[model samples]
Target: MSKDINYLIKSSIEIYFKNSQIRDISFNTFLPENRNLKSKRSKLKMEKEGKNNLRFFIESKDITAFRASINEIITFGKIFENVLNLVE
Candidate 1:
């Protein structure tokens, strides 16, 4: 990844929740150098190919509840991204 892009993503993650009370969102960038990226959300797999990808993992057992959660998350995420872009 380009340094600038990586800086932007790390900056976004750091800046987004710095003053918020949210705790469900977290990340890690440390590995032994051989482990592939792995995370579980909604029983699906999210692949990481570059620094520009924004991905999250959510899990739910109930189909209806899961759909509702997905909708809420996506809505909020879009709004948040828009706000971030505006700030830029």
Candidate 2:
């Protein structure tokens, strides 16, 4: 990924974890064993791709769950951008 995109993803994840708390959702910087089995609806995993990039992995049992998980991440990113714009 380009530097800007990587920075955005990194920032979004950091901001989300720092500011929000939701039931059944968790963030792990490192991969976890047997984590998927704990969530029947969905699971989100974030891994470092390199020094500055991140890779997000989402697993869901059905389409609805998958869509909701994706939408939630998108919403977080949008909120982060809005806050950044305000600060700037």
- Model 1 scores a TM of 0.35
Candidate 2 wrongly placed segments (more than 4 Å): 1-39
Per-residue CA lDDT of model 2 for 1-88, tens digit only, reads: 3323221111223322323332112333123432433455666665544334444667665556667666766665565557657776
Off by over 4 Å in 1: 1-49
Number of backbone-clashing residue pairs for each candidate, in the order shown = 1, 0
How does candidate 2 fare on TM-score? 0.51
Root mean square deviation (Cα) for candidate 1: 15.7
Candidate 1, 1-88: lDDT as tens digits: 3323221111111123442222222222212111342222233222332333434444544454456445644565666667557776
Candidate 1, pairs of clashing residues:
42-58
Lowest summed-lDDT stretch of 10 residues in model 1?
5-14
